[model samples]
Target: MKKLFAMLLTVSLLMVSAGAASTQSSNWAQEAVWTAQEAGLVPETLNTSYDTAITRAEFCSLAASLYRIWEANGQLKDITPSSVSFTDCTDEDVLLCASIGVVNGVGDGRFAPDSPIQRQEAASMLHRLAALRTDYAGSTKNKMPHVFFDGENIRSWARSDVYWAYNSGVMTGTGDNAFDPTGQYTREQSIVTILRLYDASYAALPVPNTEAPYHAVLDYSGAGVSRMHLEDKDGNHLLTDFEDTDGYFYDITVFGDWVGLMWNDNANVALYQPATGKRIDGYIFDGIDEKNGVAWAWAYDDENALVVYADGTTGKKFIPKTVWSEGRAIVWANANTLAAIDKNGNTLWQYKTSFNQDTLVYGLGDRVVIEQDNTNTLLANGKLGTAQTYTIIPNKWSANYIGGDNGYYTLYDQNGKALTGSYANALDEVGQDIYCRWVSDTQYEYFHCAAGGNPTTLFTVTVTNGRPGVLPTDGAGVYALQTSQNTIACFDRFGTIIGTIQTPFTLDSLADITFENGCIRVTRMDIGADTSTQTMLYLPTGEPIA
Candidate 1:
């Protein structure tokens, strides 16, 4: 039961704002730092305060706040804070002792609150709070190569307590991997530690909808479809109806500040200032000569590119054969070139070419003047780029192999260069070893390879009486051999049977499995042990990690 520092909640994204009593403090304001502060945990002050000025009463009150916040937020479930006040010295001592699970009451007993909590007294409480079980917990002796610095502080009786907390990430070492169990807990230190344990107790708890600090104002109706609205962080309605149109609409797309609304048939499409609500048609469009609301017809002659609406009039005209034949008429611009007409055969804008035009166009509205050594794209009228451009770069693997969330896993050769020809879609890294399963229209097989790339052998998995022409692994090469009885077997990179092991646990619907903190974490499970009982299987031997 070594102190587990893994429970240590790294201070992430927490802004150290002004404490509860700052310039913004008001008579009716609920304490800003109420949760941590009420837990008898003092808010970290920017300015120095009197060393011993804070009284025992204040400490208890703060501790109470921390306890309440944790409980209300589902931080601690099994244990709850008592409602009894501890003004008397005896009562105070008892409250502290019981809060940390130091002692339990005999038949008809009274706790001595006035007495100073001793080393043994505190140790007992810390031990229980650490939640150590002799039989169920992991053993550290020789399992990990390490030594404790303050090993002497742990009494023989409370050694298990100290060890459990250390191993469970609850208690961390001062330095040199040691738990100073005998050290007196400070008011601040104690409150912080207890709050941490509270956090770990219900780390996976979901927040209630009513208690959620923020929410999204979803446009379930027509407005979210036709018009765009911007809201504040607290979902305050800020900007509404950016387009502000009342005619037949075809499609609307937002590319940065530029919002495009295409009209269907023959409808007047108006662009309004999101902030001012003024008509901004002239600024958005270059010229307006056709009818206010007219439909467009396809160009009868190839020389005249029809750049008009679906009804018939020329809404926006451009040169013929400039854009792609199959795609829409939407135009895209890059650094050096002026404009790019979409497959729709309409030129959106024209840009003056610069000498150092970069071909790497990223998003829809993103535009810069510098030329890249890569792709061809352009920019129009000093607008920002959107992250919608599709550019495919050659990787350690081929473009055909990337589809998952990790984007694409390109296995590098020993020289750390991308191997030109080796690529497959169904490949994954389990531990340091990589496995590839070949999937085709017919079946899936284990693709074995000595190096990271280029499979040498394929072992087809034949499921007796199984469906035919259904490659479960999608033609990638190797299939993780699972028995009909749900047992796990490991095959070498060469598709040779290494060994077999019982499946530690069955994940009902694992959307993803990834490695983090030296362990494999499966996402999308509703119940069961998130960490324990799900041990990593030994691939080389096909044995469970015991």
Candidate 2:
């Protein structure tokens, strides 16, 4: 009887121990560990300790296995492993990772194989791995914007990699704006990041429909309240349910990969990367404008405009009224003074005008066109020449010529030298050496003129209003026009009527029309005891976007 009782007690203890071990392996990382083990990337005998910090050598081994798998899938055939030597990490897998240029030593011929891998170091390694693929090469140079509060803590060498990793969803922070770059990278985090990298490399990237580069903010009524919406240039809805909870008026603008939400209430602004929906801190601008990838913004509570680069570095210059175009800002200092400033806030050139308040400066690819009252002056390389008085073609600032009234126009080169040409009133400059000419009051023709060649008409269109409401930057020749009936008419550069779309509400009910990157944005006002505004977006093709 005594022996039976002792055996039963021992069996019960064994059962309890087994239960505890099973529970430990059944957590969130259990499937990942199992998958890695099955693929032979991780040892089957390894005990699952998800919370434990990963060592350098251990991570290298895992990375090597992943690279080998990728190579087996025919993605890394050009990548040949080179010979490398490290004092500590002499293991075959660790050496393989180094030879493949995915891992490096900590100097002094040592790999620090047993040392815990820091978060930033892991990010760097992952970035290197991603660079091996052509699809990800463009992202490798992307600088880390001010997305985190502790972004300054990140080492310079690791900034790009860390930024790419975080924004691409390969890694996340430990809550708040802190990235914890110096903290230990745990086994669970490493596995998760590796999986995410794999998905990013193999998944189909999202592509916007339109080739134009612009984003728009629209407002509408839904569920008995006002809501704001965001749309890309392709008319795709990005944010459809954004509410103005504070009841503040706002404006939206895009600067390269960053989007700015400027509000009139206290001059508050919010910046975000539309691609990743990640909020970028440390930038305050009342208004933003961009040319190429360089941007200039009106700083809050200051008279100066801040020039910002893609890397989040800024330079300030005093400019009251500024408009950015073709990598330069044309600033109107005072009534008679206009200066062209580069991205570094250096004045490239200055011009004296004869008008104030009625003066408009437009930057066009190394040329500045100053229009005041009824006169237009073209300034290039410190030389000022008068332009024809006709409405400077509605779009195409870089065109060497200006169209005049009564089927007349004048052509010139960038240096303001007159180019001899017999041309009609150009409605718009569609592309390089291409123009949309007015054939009649209701007709237009597309003409292409090659250098040293006669102009050729490509197509013709018969429409009521060939005049574009918004400029075509994509060179596709498509135009959006507002018709007399408050409807939007879509016409090709050659005057072909593609389609017509009605407004969400009515033009009479709206206050103004704004042309944003081929889309029409309008605001409707409800003037009562308490006034309110609603904005809407319409594609150039006349289709309403959300």
Per-residue lDDT of 136-202 in model 1, one digit per residue for the tens? 2344421121124334234434444544454444445554234455554444334444545545552
TM-score of each: 0.25, 0.38
Q: Going through the candidates in order, what is the number of backbone clashes in each?
A: 75, 2
Q: Using TM-score, give the best candidate's number.
A: 2
What TM-score does candidate 1 reach? 0.25
- Model 1 residue 118 lDDT score: 30
lDDT of the structure predicted as candidate 1? 0.36
Computed on alpha carbons, the lDDT of every model, listed in order, comes to 0.36, 0.59
User: Across residues 451-515, which tens digit of lDDT does each residue of candidate 2 receive?
Assistant: 34356665565555346333333222344544544565555433445457676665552445655
Worst 10 residues of 1 by lDDT: 470-479
